[model samples]
Target: MATVADGHHPFAFTFGILGNLVSTMVYLAPVPTFYRIYRKKSTEGFHSVPYLVAMFSSMLWLYYATLKKNAMLLITINSFGSFAEMIYIVIFVVYAPKDARKLTVKLFGIMNVGLFTSIIVVSHFLVSRAYRVPVLGWINVAISTSVFAAPLSIVAQVIRTRSVEFMPFRLSFFLTLSAVMWFAYGLFLKDICVAIPNVLGFVLGLLQMLLYAMYRNRKQVIIEDHEKKLPAATPDHVKNLVIIATLAASEVHPVEAQPNNRNDDGDVNNNAAITEANEHEQTDDHRHVENASVEIQPNETPSAV
Candidate 1:
């Protein structure tokens, strides 16, 4: 357990501390998320896969930090992450419905308990002591890289939805800052395992921030408010009346044709003729309607009685 001061590169040590601070904030970013879940008393369609994977990643990193020397920063941040992810999982399980709870528990058992135990046993028993750290470091690297890439789903969502509602700028900003800090710390610490994943993290974080900026105001799917309901279908009589009125009015005030219009051999005149035909049709329909109403009247009127 070498302190940051004990290391030859004090800059690396300082960066590690900074990384720890930033990473801690990144880890705590989900507190509000979980709180919302808690207050709602339901998982509200939010999947538990993320927390499960995060816990798994933290566990893997924790194991790696324990094996590697002078990786106290890795040890600390991952430790915090492991604890935080666990609490989040617990909250999720409690609020989740029966099917979700079952699925979550199954994944935790397979990934965290069963799969994790298998990794420990295989690495411990089969791998040599000298190669153990390297093997684990590479494995951790792979997992960390994947964890960083998990945000790509959100990126795709942001792009497809053109909305930044689910992808908060603050979260992306902190993730980017954490990535920068951790990368610097790992660079100083001279641990490739710690350095590699943060490289990807930094890139993804920047991409998320870019997406947030590009789409903060613009969305792919515009959910224009349909507060005003569509007008009901026009009644047949009403439609006829409107059509008749429009036709009669147009015929009364027909537009004068220009020389170019007259060149087409009564092209403008055709419109006026059409309006006259429409008016005739409407007058015929109105007369038929009046006749039908008269036919369907009561046998005797009140004045006649």
Candidate 2:
């Protein structure tokens, strides 16, 4: 019995080599974030799913490489990938909250250990080496496809909040670029397994960038709305007048209040007295209102009046 040679072209080989280098760089890009987590002693709001999926992808690729002849590049890159992702996961677990740490441990058990062992056992016992390669290739395809779906949660968040604060543009840009490089490499190498998932990755990356652009300005708008809703304080003149009126009323009053007289000449002296009293009362009320307004402004200074 004879085995078929995996097709390889020079262009495809070169592309694959380049793609691997670029992918390695991108994979290591999370170093700064992990460093922060290490320093802070907390994972904050960061999720562990990306690192988990990345580890799973690397593991799948490594399995596929074992089945394929002359897959040195694949094995090399994915080995680095496995180490990087494991380190990220470890950092996350160290800094994550109790519930998050528990969840991450469970995920590692289910995905990395249990599921991976099952695949290895089944593939080794049931399949020949030649068939093993193809089976693992398809498995890699499946894992990568699922990885592409992970960004949907972020997309939904962006839509709901109308904010792209969590979705960094540089990340989307690099992801899309990495996907393109990998896709080209896979296409040249005639490896449909590698090319297909990257197509989805590229599309998702583009969508994320677009969403980021759309909602980047929304933060300013939200701040402006808050500013518009705040109340303006009363002017100083009213406050001063009220204080003066209250002081005058308390300190200087005529011994007897003058009475208004209305005669047949239609001169109503009482009306004048009533009007003057009403004016004085209104002046006091205005001062009281202004004083209340000033008091409500927590950090205001009297000099501001």
Candidate 3:
């Protein structure tokens, strides 16, 4: 049977094309985020490290594609990735704060320029041709694995906050799909170097999905917590009724202490005779009418004294 232009099986070529399409979407995922940065003329505290590292990854993959045979798909996709990542980095630097911009530039220089150059030179000159591809392959694999794991920080944030606000489900779903597609492409192409990293990618994608499931009801979590912290409410009318009832009860059976006649007779005698006589009359009146009382009905308004 005939094969594709790269001598790859038709299925492999088809999957590679699918992978390219999906990965392209993944690469462009930050377009909206960057567009906001541009519109506001500020990075809004977004980090450029992801884009910088992405650019370096694409560059390395592009180099590896050139070194290997029949890797046109890899070259093409990674070329676009490199360009896209560079554009993202540029936008980030333009809008980032001064200190952030400086740090971004330094990171770009060290990783994209210095480290990438060093890798190419060392691999091309020091390593034998037979071993160069494997060495580069391993390096790409390590970096790609780290890239796959990078979103764990996001997972951690979600778990800590008990919220999926930071983890968009669409992104997670597509990334998982991309991993599956690329894994099949690598398998069909019989490329272990391409296949290895995607295994980790798929695992991370599933983890992200699991986390999304666990925290998707973040609003409910917040509500439950808020309810737990909130004090129970008392109705205004109920509180008013309670105050009125208490006052009525207190008036109905007001307690009054009598002066100790024996021991405090001198103190009582110091008061005016008229005051003492009035108090005795009041005490006698209270005793006489103690059984006669007004009942406080719940529905009745309290009467003024």
- In model 1, how large is the Cα lDDT of residue 41? 96
Per-residue lDDT of model 3, residues 1-305, tens digit only: 11354457677778888888998998888888788889999875466776887889899999998998777788889999999999988998888899989999999999999999999999999999999998998999999888887776666656665766556777777888888887887788888888899998899789988988988977567545534543242344323422232221101111122223343456567666779889999999997676444454557876799
C-alpha lDDT (0 to 100) for residue 32 of candidate 3: 82
Best candidate according to lDDT: 3
| Candidates ranked, most accurate by lDDT first | 3, 1, 2
76-112 per-residue lDDT for model 2 (tens digits): 7889999999989998898899998999999999999
For all predicted structures, in order, the TM-scores are 0.71, 0.68, 0.71
List runs of model 3 lying over 4 Å from the truth.
1-5, 223-305
CA deviation > 4 Å runs, candidate 2:
1-7, 222-305
| 10 residues in a row with least lDDT, candidate 3 | 246-255
Which structure is stronger by lDDT: 1 or 2?
1
Q: CA lDDT, every prediction?
A: 0.73, 0.72, 0.75
Better of 1 and 3 by lDDT: 3
Instruction: Supply the global lDDT for candidate 1.
Output: 0.73
